[model samples]
Target: MSQVPMITLNNGVQIPQVGFGTFKVDAAVTQQAVENALEAGYRHIDTAAVYGNEEGVGAALRAVNLPRDEVFVTTKLRNGEQGRDLVQRAFEESLGKLGLDRVDLYLIHWPAPALGTYTEAWAELESIHRQGGARAIGVSNFLPHHLETLVEGAEVTPAVNQIELHPSFQQPATQAASREHGLAVEAYAPIGQAKDLDLETVTGIAREHDVTPAQVILRWHLQQGTVVIPKSVTPERIVANIDLFGFELDEEQVAAITALDSEERMFPHPDEGNFTMLD
Candidate 1:
């Protein structure tokens, strides 16, 4: 088993640098997938209310029989539940599904600024953090401009900003802003969803490292000090993804991968045309 590294948040809490993400994972198969990830040594699990698999994830944690404190579970506040008053209900519902008294981290799934609700949501997150319902709080898919507005209106600085980051779309501006604000940067699609494997640069690195393209990509994220969550349902791939700490990418290799950034995003904007999942 590979040893995963840990990063310290702005509030001085430690979180795993690499985690297992359950984004599109079906609820019916989520329990077994999570169990496999746990067995493969993933201490962190990233989920969301929108994913509709918290109950499955919770079942895995329970089935693993690991001490509750041994694993770090994170769930997000979905768009529909984005106000101060509604957030309390949302958090409780997530907790109930996870069967945990408190989640390790809770995130504002997205900043639906057009609706003008994230400001209220941030306050509710701060309240949740203070009340110990969530050990840490963060935002997802937030750009620098969005973060700035959030900071201006937020009472607590978000501890982490989860975004679509990979070799092809590095988001340097977001990374710089996160570093400047003491918010940890988390890469949601560090392997480019395996879409960039055929890229010459990525293939070249994988050959040099004697590893798979996905491992090379993940190593790049780790070298940049960005937390990465790469999802895979296959057990062999899950094991292979976690086997990254054994090797190190040199400066030249890191730069080679970093140079591939085109600032493009693979996922569609959750904030386009004032449309939202809630609607």
Candidate 2:
């Protein structure tokens, strides 16, 4: 296994800087895909109830048979399931499917401001963490205002806030709030959903380093101190994503990549009718 870098959470847990995200992976194909990522030496696995693949991911875990502490597993509370009661039930369902008594990290998949219950749901997650059901609890896709409310009402500070953070969607304001609150930042779609794969700047950097564009981008996220989850079902890409610790990006190169932030969010907000809440 490569010496993958680790990011220290607020509670001081060291999580692998790069994780394998099993988002949108077909349930039928997820088991093999996750198994391939594990074989590639990925120590972190990110899944969610909305992804509908916790069972498949759990199967991969059993197949790998790696010691529990050696791998970090994370899951999230889905949008429709955001509430005191529903959130508690949703978490139990995820835990049951993942076949784990406690998750390394658990999160509110989205704030669901429109539904008007994330604050209460956050309190529920705080309870989950207190009960030792999850080592760390956090939120996803939350804006600064959302986080402020969470901080004001939450008994426990969220250890992380996972969001869309590709080069084009840097989310500087959100990142600032997370930092101010002592929350670790986790970047989903860190490679920009393949949008940055062929960009001249990214490709040029890859060529200069004799690495793939994907590797270059993942390296940029790591250097920026963001926990990145790059999802790939292919075995070769799984190995390629984590093979980034061998090189370093200097200040100028890092700045050039940082300049690519355009705040473009590939996934539309749930409030914009992209999703509907269920009772």
Candidate 3:
């Protein structure tokens, strides 16, 4: 019953500010979860090749009976498939799994800097965008330095940069870098994985706003002009996550939440080159 606001990407494409994230969601249950999200008015759905649930997501999309253009679907290229040739094949494979000809957004899942092939992979994404296979293209888990390497010889600036952003790990430098390049920031772990939802600052703000700490954190993300994809398989939480339009966090509340940034990451640093998932 809540309306999700849309944010304009650099390419003039509008995306829902809050989306449903399918990370760590079991493939067996993904379809139902996505169905619930769509029913709850989540038009944007974010998943990745690494999540291994694209097939289920596709099934849900097909089952929903909504117009294809009514929903915004995003999937990412896997780390192993980082070369131009491999990326093309990977995109086709993801498309086949999703049962859709075009995705609303396509992202390079990670820079995988050690592999040293992201620039080439980015070229392939640009081609996909030009050919209309993807409405917009972006990168995930990319730090400022990684983005710098990507844009050196690139033709199209990345439309979005999905990163490990939450209250505890605000990623100010990376967020600033993204804004500098006209890239929209998408917060992947926007709720901090429930790690800091109970922090005094978060709870105090939640109490002041009379909402859950998760909602407060998500509101903070929204107020900061970032897109947030909070993952939840529970139907109630899925409904609650998008019910964020009613309240607004004040300047001091926003500053208090901003001060909670501890510079800690819930996921591995991109520079660590943790591509074991590819294996």
Candidate 4:
């Protein structure tokens, strides 16, 4: 089994640099997919309440029979559950669904700035962390400005900021801001969700490195000091995604991929205030 590298978060929690994500995975197959990932050597698993697969994830974890502490699990508070009281309740409900006492990490899934309660939600997450409901607390889909608002009033800095990042959308400004505040950046869609893997630059680099474009892209993320969660239901891809530690990218190759950044985001902008997921 390949050993995944770990990155220490600002709060001193250690997370695997490469993780398996269960974003769009169907609940029916989520268990088997996660099991395949674990059997393939992935110890970190990222899921969200809105993803509708927490139960499946729980089932897989139980089936694997590994010591609970040996694996890291992360889940999020849905956009609809954005206030202090609601977040607390939502977290308990998520725990119930996952059948776990606590998650390794719990995240406020999005800023939902229109709701005007993300900061309050952050406070609740802090309370949960204090009470040991979550080992670590953080936010997702949060822009630097949103993080600034959070930091101004927050008593504890977020351990991480999960964002939609890829070679095509490097988010240098956001990445820099996260580093400035000592928050670890976790990249969702680390392989561009297949959006730019076929680009000439990525493919050319892959050819030079004798790796698939996906491997090249994931390696780029790892080299940039970001945690990446690449999701796949296919067994081969799940196994292949974690097979990233064997190679390293040269500075020019890394720069060529970095230059592919145009700041084009594939997901909704957090500032746009779309909480349509609540609907």
Candidate 5:
């Protein structure tokens, strides 16, 4: 059912490279937004406990009534829920909210290096994988050093590293580290929070391809082998986000977009802000 390309994780779990993201999607509208996404042919849905909308994602899954195997659902453990024991409990809570027996992918939303508990939490994630509670386990917002530390201390190498990535703020070092460690780089804010949509390089390419700048940016991500999860509640935008399989970007077009990387991250760095989950 998915015409979108699938990126096989290190563990052999195939994830749709272009998934629907629900970062700030309000809980009240998350279900409908997710429904719009599913109806528009999105087979992957990324959410988190901090987002407070797993229930909506779950509802959309049930409403869409696609074969469970056909959809790859990813949710993260909240920053507040990072203890060895707490992570397990958090995973259960997320599963309950999503109404799933097992998730396709479960990630620690942040490394939370200040807490000094990520390694312990990773241990529990490994145990969960062993027990079939999660098909894959990963970390989000981790930088290169954090990735090095986590991989050094943990048994299960993360299957994916979800991070802030867009044309203007691509973290090349982090991407290199993730690839070096065998983790798939999953890009959140794939469209640069609308900041990169109007850049001359992106727009020029978009005009050449007869697509939106958002589409151009997304196409750039896909061509470079990163998984992109772009969020949108608007029905037209939702449909347009996943409409990426029809065209291919040639070498020069891809390079021009790649040249836009400024290392300017649009979101909080892994070690910078409050480690606590959002309200």
Candidate 6:
């Protein structure tokens, strides 16, 4: 097993810098996919209620028999499920589905400002944290303004901000805002969904390191102190995604990849619609 590096969040919870993502993974295969990832030395598994695979993730955990603390599990509230009346119930449903008493991290999947209940959702998350139901609470797909609004009434600071960050679409402003509030930045599409693998800069760096472009890109994120969850159902790819610690990217190579940022966000703007990151 590769010695994956850990990022200590503001609340003192440590998460693997490299994690196996289950965003688009099918429920029918989600169990086996998570099983294969666990066998491949992945200690972190990211799934959401919207992903509809928390049961499969739990099944895989039962099958693997690894200690609960060995794996870091994260889930999110559905886009339409954010409010004082609904948020707590939704979180309990996620926990019941995952077969766990608590989750390592729970996030409000979206701000859905139009719904105007994210601050209320944060209150419930804070309550969950106080009750020891969620080790950490955070938000996803939140912009700077959303963060500002959330913190105004939040008694607890979010530990993380999961966003659609990738090599091709680095939202530097959002990252700056998240850091300003002491939240750890997490990247969902860290590889740009493989659209960045064929880039000249990425390929050159991959060739220099004798690794795949995916590994190089993930390593770049790691070197920059960002948590990345690259998803794959294929066993080989799952294994390859976490095998990143063996090699490292130097400053020049990391810079070349960072220069590829074009603000070309592949996902919808956070404020535009109630996107659940379903794609």
Put down candidate 4 lDDT per residue, 1-279, tens digits, no spaces. Answer: 446788999888899999999999999999999999999999999999999999999999999988998899999999888866788889998999898999999998888888888889898999999999988999888888998999999998999999999988878888889889999999999988898889999999888878889999999998888999999999999988889877899999998888888867898888895584651
Tens digit of per-residue lDDT, candidate 6, span 150-197: 988889999999999988999999999999999999999899888999
- How many residue pairs clash in all the candidates, one count each? 0, 0, 0, 0, 0, 0
Against the hidden true structure, what lDDT does model 2 obtain?
0.89
Please report how far candidate 2 places residue 81 from its true position, in Å: 1.4
- What are the candidates' C-alpha RMSDs? 1.4, 1.4, 1.2, 1.1, 1.2, 1.6
Q: lDDT winner among the candidates?
A: 3
Least well predicted 10-residue stretch by lDDT in candidate 4: 270-279
Alpha-carbon deviation at 126 in model 4, angstroms: 0.6
**Where's the lowest-lDDT run of ten residues in candidate 6?**
270-279
The TM-score that candidate 3 achieves is 0.97
Which pairs of residues clash in candidate 3, taking residues 3 or more apart in a chain or in different chains?
Answer: none
Judged by whole-model lDDT over C-alpha atoms, candidate 5 comes out at 0.89
Worst 10 residues of 1 by lDDT: 270-279
Query: Candidate 1 has which clashing residue pairs, if any?
Result: none
Residue pairs with backbone overlap in model 5 = none
lDDT of 1 by residue, 102-199 (tens): 99899988877787888888998999999999999999888888889889877789999999999898889888998898899999978888887778
Q: lDDT tens digits, residues 157-232, model 2?
A: 9999999898888999999999999999999999999998888888988989999999999999988889999999
Of the two candidates 2 and 4, the one with more favorable lDDT, higher being better, is 4
Candidate 4 pairs with clashing backbones? none
